[model samples]
Target: MEQPLPKSWSIHTRPEVIAKYEILERVGSGAYSDVYRARRLSDNLIVALKEVHDYQSAFREIEALQMLHNCPNIVVLHEYFWREDEDAVLVLEFLRTDLAAVIRDAKKKEGGIRVGEIKRWMLQILCGVDACHRNMIVHRDLKPGNLLVSDDGVLKLADFGQARILMEPGFDGDDDNHQLPVEQNTGYQENVTPPLDVVADAHSLPDQGFNKQVVEDTNREEYLRQLVELKAKRHAVDETDKETNINDGYSSCLATGTISDIDDDPLKSSYSYDAEEGGDGRNGALTSCVGTRWFRAPELLYGSTDYGLEVDLWSLGCIFSELLTLEPLFPGISDIDQLGRIINVLGNLTEEVWPSCCKLPDYKTISFAKIENPTGLEACLPNKSADEISIVKRLVCYNPASRATTMELLNDKYFDEEPLPLPVTELHVPLTKNNHDEDSPGGWHDYDDMGSDSDFGDFGHFKVENTGSGFSMQFS
Candidate 1:
């Protein structure tokens, strides 16, 4: 017997979406979006409908996915519906599990994750990230939960809500077409007037309870008025000589909820980061407040907005570290503490390591005491071989320029050794579904709680001191 849809889910449903697919259940919910597992009415195929409430996140995800269409390692975006006043609903391919589940399940096994399995997961992630980087797209948020896996064992990169395009192919610094529009700057668009035929079709559809036409008209009018006021404010800022920082418009913290909080409650409120202007004449300055706290790069931790694809490389290193040890490399409670954990292991950030370190936005604002003997990567992965540690060292570093590129890591001899990367068909896919639901345990919402009980003594002892100025570290 078919189960009835919950009444609360009605808030996420739209006449157009209901017209095309049968909503089975709410699979995921976040600050600005809700994902539902639905079956297409046309072919009865299962799909995930991601209804995004934030305009900027929706636009960036749609644009990035469209640009990455047909990339095997990346998530597939089927189609989407966007109305002037309604939240954008994106139709996406549904995967059963993610890397987080794999890691979680591995912890229960006798010998832990197989060498071949680790190699395969790492390779797939590199392939997906390589594709994104080659296309000039920076997946600001990269974590175990975002790496979804199919039943056939193919891992695809998902959740591009925080992605940014540095430049298009053959993009010259002087090209105005590459620049983000004012609408993108303000995170809202003007009302888009639909075609007459589309309007007629919408009216022809049966109403569930309320009058659709009247409701849409009223919302559209009110939204247009608000947009006008926003545009006026934006124009005034543009005319000023003072530089405009993206942080001025919104909060730097993407979400106040911790990993534990998100795991216990998936519907927690979240925040968004705005892209700033100026970055070697590219689209714009990328936001530093991206990715989950644990996997965030050193540059991003110190608030470096003028970063590059290296940020993702740092995240890849963290993910790889977790794969090897089944534990997060640097699991810090807050951004300040996150840096402290890194500095505890990798030593202090100095000008000798990365010359441009002084240019970071919060470099001077946040300071840490020097470490006499930093616990190196080898200490973190105690039983792992030198090759494994070497691979990770190539990535998780203070110097963005020094970090290994995706292509370089892909070509590394690590994948060529015995117990080679398992073939996609032979790879073990966890049966647990990675629906972004409060009840399920394998999605972005659940990452914070993973390995929460692990001992941090392996990285050595370090105390985080709260200097009234900012956070600093004291090594014992």
Candidate 2:
């Protein structure tokens, strides 16, 4: 009798045997994954292979990929298969550098951004988010690192690592603990951290009698008590005896992959930095999952139970600002420093903004500093206008409930009257004369509209060029 293979083996493909999809180079890596540039054996098309260690995470990505196949703004997931070694490789469309690298490079060249480019990128991001919302998927993580720019300067949303797939037609993806937060308290309900999620659920639930009784009889006090107990229990493990006020577990998980010895003793880092190391359950990379400290949402940084895609949205807004300013909106050197940075840029959270943060899962440990101090986007991006700042404010609102929705963001005044340029027409990709063969593999610079002859890829050159419409690309 032959041994049976696991259900996951269904998607497996033997790369060694098939002689297709050869690895070109290692381009990217994550906490539990590595991404390589690959070419299709038959079609000779360049693609990206994201290899994952965890089977379930890979499965979840595949599930989401199938749902998002039709969305153009999202990175196209071509196929998924397992190597003979059982390592899963998700064949994705090949794209150029991510926004994080792009912005950093752009900043270094001219030391900042041109307003016109900022407008274009922000609209693109909004379109991407809107597409995700229409598909009923919430990207759990959205940051500069996850955003990739094609060689032609097309911005695409990628990395569905923390994405939540909403069931289409009549399907619901939240059955069992499939969609629950990794750090979700045992007795808690998996309500959406998004304003849309909270509102939709609020309306869906019954308001009278038995439901009322259930709500009343339920010890609101008890659930919080349990959360406190669990948080206490979690803290008690090693550092609990020391009683250091660390926050979420993302930084810690990151450390696990980065450093192993810290697991034993009380390692010393900045207070704010250590706060990030504390994992919020275990949602991010076991190592290097800290995408960007400045882009972290208030809920994740301050500790909120209802945190979810809303956090990602917040990061996107800040990223958009960073692209424009060529600087992080909130570059918190330490965890406490992050709070100050946020307040300085977005204004401090007020009762008028976030009234019930105290009830959140991370609330107890959250130090709600006085609203006496404040941060607003305009102050952070002194070069940006009120309208530009308005867009950021709506997305990065302290109260998750008040944050902007994908739909609302799409309809923002920023895009109210402008036309979004198409890929074939709007992009001005000057293909390198040396790599003119469409069939032959092109180097990174050859494909990039803004890239130079340099190996790292030329970045940050802005020149003003008027378009048919009022909107323009400042690339002179």
Candidate 3:
């Protein structure tokens, strides 16, 4: 029998290591991974090969892609190879450019991505998000840069490093349990069914022997009163429990100094000029301090840990608007500035708009200049048609619950209106331009020349082009 190859592939072995594949060039890099455009030796077909230094992130991404690859709108994972040095490599379908690059290319053209093209891309994006949500996954980091476009015009959602699995409602394991893998849980035993009581569904209703008609007629008013009281009690209890979990989670993160302790903490603290020392009191999986600065949702801005898929919808709204203007809708320099930019466009968040805003962790601490009667979307997105503006209005809503869902957005009349969504094949985005040179410091083969025993080597040669909105670069 033939011996199986090891998961940890050595990077030091140049052309001889993965003899079947050839490294074409270095394409992109992030805090954790380096991306390369490579060719499969067998077929000579190109692929985007991402070498992730973070083992857990690679594991999370592989798991997510295993479930998400079936969706046509999502990027397809071709193969996964492991490295013995705590690194992982993933092979994915190559695309011409990402939506951010497409947007930039459009700026140089006569008429940027047209209305039909924008609508088409937006629909495809929504389809991808729908796929993730259907699989109980959330793409916490949805941005133009992560949305890849092919030369033939298909838009595929990529980058799952920050993705997460959402636990079902009423699931009793630690609400923050999603953040920790099963192996990491205390006293975790294999093949042991969770304690029935702990996993019981909270929303499941109880049965009664009484007839339905008799009960409704007799207990209508009384039933409503009881229901109201029950809801109030449940809300109070849930809030208190969630608050405790948040505090405990943050305390644990602060103590251990683990990178995953705080959501959005790493990138924000290092990059943002005015980011707080420790993130804004977000704890566990609920508070995803992910998403880029300009595309960040309003709930995240207010430090709400209970946010859900609507947060992504808010980002879609921003991206959709950007497709029209070729600029970020809210170009805030810092978190405070970002909030101010939002308030300037959408107006202040009052009890009437989002009744739960005042309850957010940072609500009491951060104060904004009150602006009466905020400007409408039409004023900000004057170039967009009425239907386009309507969709934008629904996406960037104050209350997360009130935001339009993926399916709802799909069914909206805006899609049915004039300038119908273009077919994917008809869409046009500029071809990718490789700005980095092969001979550059961080270029391809930087590690190949090093001794084979060397685990890793850093040859930093990344180039940045100011997009005027903020620094925009491709991340793997």
Candidate 4:
């Protein structure tokens, strides 16, 4: 009897992948994976082969890509396969360069990225971000390096290594009194099958199949439409379920053991600050010391775990500022230093200024040095147009609640300015020449190479481990 052929592409061995696709050269390497420009042997079609060694990061990126594959602004995941304990090979669409290279090249060759080009790139970035947010996923890491730019001038959001999926719709923090009803998809529960349009045939492999069903664009739109309707229904249900706080802004009697009595916790009375006496009685479930120090939000620095997409908006503001000036707005050495730099620019984070500042976990322990005069964004970007100034200000606003969402930025009047954003092809940003051989020079290879210290603050300690085929690096 002859040996049977592998039923699924995923079951194929490493030699099989090499036989089907010819790996030309290693184009890029990072803390977790190595990237190569390859050609499909059958048709000579070019593609990117990413050898992901970290199991957790690979799965996270795969899940994010599955949910966002149909988004045009997001990088397309053509196909992927895992072989036991071996690296998960992800075949992604070939993109010429990254935004970091484009910006760096512009600064070196031209004076700066043209205003029109900036608008175009920013709009596309926001589109990708909005799609992620709509699906209740947050791209926690948003920087120029991670954004890939194709030869056709199309900006695609790449690198979902640090993305997070929200369990609840939006960031309506865990509430006890107002028990919001879980909005279920029509005839679909957590264990139920996907919609008819999204579900594939019975013969199709359920998971980890190379020829898995690709999500169609129409299916994505329909899914989003249903999500919007579900949110509306949830809102209506929430309105009826909510119980009025008769105490209003004041603290309810602790002795009464009412609904607002902090669940009868005796520790509620121990705090020096009282909610009734003008304190922000917020108890957020935030963790400290996460994300890169430089682009970290003020709330994060203050130890506010109750943050949402607004933290990303704050980071974007920093990136937007850097694009214009070619330098980070607040390049702090440490977490405390980062908070100090923010205060130096946006003024003190006082109780009067930000009512919620007092509620942060670290507020009582940490004391930011008072700055005499806060040099605002206007002073920092003197040449920035009024429209640019306005948008950045809203993004890196002192209050996280006041920060604009990605969708809001898309509608801003800034895009309608004189000399409208250049058409995709008209944009004169840099593009890397595709290399397919060992003799080829590394063009834009360092575009997303773990970023520089200037961009991500100092890396404490990083280790590189060598696998049989490639190497994987881990940051401490």
- The prediction achieving the highest TM-score against the true structure is 1
The per-model lDDT (C-alpha) reads 0.64, 0.48, 0.56, 0.57
Separately for all candidates shown, the number of backbone clashes (residues 3 or more apart, or on different chains) is: 1, 24, 4, 1
Provide the lowest-lDDT 10-residue window in model 4. Answer: 264-273
Q: What is the lDDT of residue 333 in candidate 4?
A: 52
Tell me the TM-score of each prediction against the true structure: 0.73, 0.61, 0.68, 0.65
lDDT of 3 by residue, 1-476 (tens): 99875544344353332675688766665456667778988899988777777655666676677676556777877776663443666778887577776776676689888877787777778767766755556666677767877787777778787566655311111222233241211122332232111111101111111112322343444534543443354345334545333421221001111122222111111111111211343333354345565677876666555555566778888888888887768765445556666887788877788766766655654556568767767888876677778888888878765677665565566665657666666677665533223454532112111111101112112234465444422111
lDDT of 1 by residue, 142-191 (tens): 88878888888888888887777754211111222332232212112222
Model 3 score (lDDT) = 0.56
TM-score of 2: 0.61
Cα deviation at 363, candidate 3, in Å, is 1.2
Q: Residue 269 CA error for candidate 2 (Å)?
A: 23
**What is the descending lDDT order?**
1, 4, 3, 2
Candidate 3, which ten residues in sequence have the lowest lDDT sum?
196-205
Put down candidate 4 lDDT per residue, 257-361, tens digits, no spaces: 111111111001111111221124332222333344556677666654445656778878887887777666776655555666788789887866665566554
lDDT of model 1, residue 54: 70
Per-residue error (Å), model 2, residue 119: 2.2
- Superposed model 3: Cα runs more than 4 Å off: 1-17, 169-284, 433-476
User: Candidate 4 local accuracy as lDDT?
Assistant: 0.57
Candidate 2, 365-466: lDDT as tens digits = 333345554545667767666777888778777766566665455445564333322322243322321222345342211211110111111223334344
